[model samples]
Target: MTKPRGRGRPKGGTDSRSRILAAAIEEFGERGYEGATIRSIAARAGVDSALVHHYFGTKADLFADAADVPLRPDVVVPIILSGPRDEVGERIVRYVLESFERDDVRRRGVMLLRTAVGGKVGSPLIIGFLTRELLPRVARRLDVPDAELRAELVASQIAGMLMIRYVLGVKPIADAPIDELVARVGPTIQRYLFD
Candidate 1:
């Protein structure tokens, strides 16, 4: 008897997801989100278009999977939701710094920052990330009335820091010690977290 067609993702696959993820990152890095297409990513991965679709439902889904921050939504969402607004500043700052400091963080952070700079508007990958992934976590943590603005502010602050510290390698901040950098910037982040 002929084998029945596999539904969803096919079995006996090894690292297909990783291949798609790596290819997606390269595509987004080079093409920006708006310009990156499933076809292009599939080509880069040497997989059929259907495989890409089967692995990840859409480009945004692919991004979330690839850039998957490993931020425990279960833990994060509740922390933000339960914490007092005043304390959000510190929590958000600490959370972001810790997240970015990781090795994997740089890979995904760079991709996100590139998309931001490239102005990948209409890219839900970034938008949903900022709003659904990042913001609500921040907004819930803070007690500020302007949670929306605060969330955006947090993104702006991190983006600027990444640009100077990681991306451009600006003079003073370039080689600053992580502790010193956090010490100096932490308070400001605290303010944003609390304010």
Candidate 2:
């Protein structure tokens, strides 16, 4: 007679969801959003692809769950755009800095940055996320000529700042107080977006 199978994930015990998420993170980090498939994630997690689907509805959903940061673009975009146009840069900078204050959030941000900067695997994912989710929203709100270019410039600045501050852990930029950093960087971002 055939043996009865266990009820949970064969490799990671009962926390299959966590395993899937962790695997998703690794897969996404290594292969990026488009390159990392549910099959690959499931294989990495040592579970069936169906299990991945069961845990997360789709690849986008998996990314959302895996990234697991409070600073979701959908939510933050509206907030940043809602404020006065002149102050939008300040708001964006402050929001990004404030989000990194939390240890977990900071770690996730680092993972994303590492993946994005590493090259082909993660770059497109980050760029797509920024361009699709954030740039369009900000650009639409600005309603200015070359809005797309301005948005891309803003994205570049933010990505560079994050790399310097959190990923590389460079001095001054990394060590400075959030408010001071924001003050120093906010206007530059403002100029990128508005000027």
Candidate 3:
């Protein structure tokens, strides 16, 4: 007769991937992206460091997966670019707000933002990800003389809104309806992208 199979997950009772992701988030949150290491995450997850490499090839990829952002720049940038140039700003703002409206996404975003703002190491990762990946793509699509500058400006505005509304939980702005925010902020973002 064959030996009986173990109960629960294949490796003990824990789901390795999920545990790794949770550990990754916690490590990144506490140590920031720069400081967080696969070994540390693995230790936290109760897995071998090789498991992290097996699951995610690179640190950046791991960070992206751990973040689990609802509105990924790769997805949003193309959508914004597909529309009329003049409407790009408004579309971007609307997309961001709409994405954040989802509880799961918002929670993840808020956690990431909090971690990002918590330390020297985390902030740079967040900024670099935005500047390097998202803004440049949008700017390239805009094809304007000062596309880079415009993108930076737009990022500033969006970041501010995110901080005030979600991070800080400021009363008026946080409490305001999505439509109201879109109407108020959309025009400025449009001007930044177009004008």
Off by over 4 Å in 2: 1-16, 19-71
Q: Using alpha carbons, what is the TM-score of model 2? A: 0.69
The estimated TM-scores of all candidates read 0.63, 0.69, 0.69
- Model 3, span 70-178: residue lDDT tens: 4567776887779887666668788888888876667667658876787664577678887788878887888678999998898889988998998788989999988
Could you give candidate 2's per-residue lDDT for residues 49-79 as a string of tens digits? Answer: 9888877898878876777655677777888
User: By lDDT, highest first, what's the ranking?
Assistant: 2, 3, 1
Query: How many collisions per candidate?
Result: 5, 0, 0
Q: Which 10 residues in a row give candidate 3 its minimum summed lDDT? A: 5-14
- Which candidate number has the best lDDT? 2
lDDT of 1 by residue, 28-128 (tens): 76677878999999888777878888989998888667666555665775764466654544565566666777866766777777776776443555677
For candidate 3, what is the lDDT?
0.78
Stretches off by above 4 angstroms in model 1 are 1-12, 34-69, 77-91
lDDT of each: 0.70, 0.79, 0.78
Name the lDDT value of residue 32 in candidate 2.
Answer: 54
**TM-score attained by model 1:** 0.63
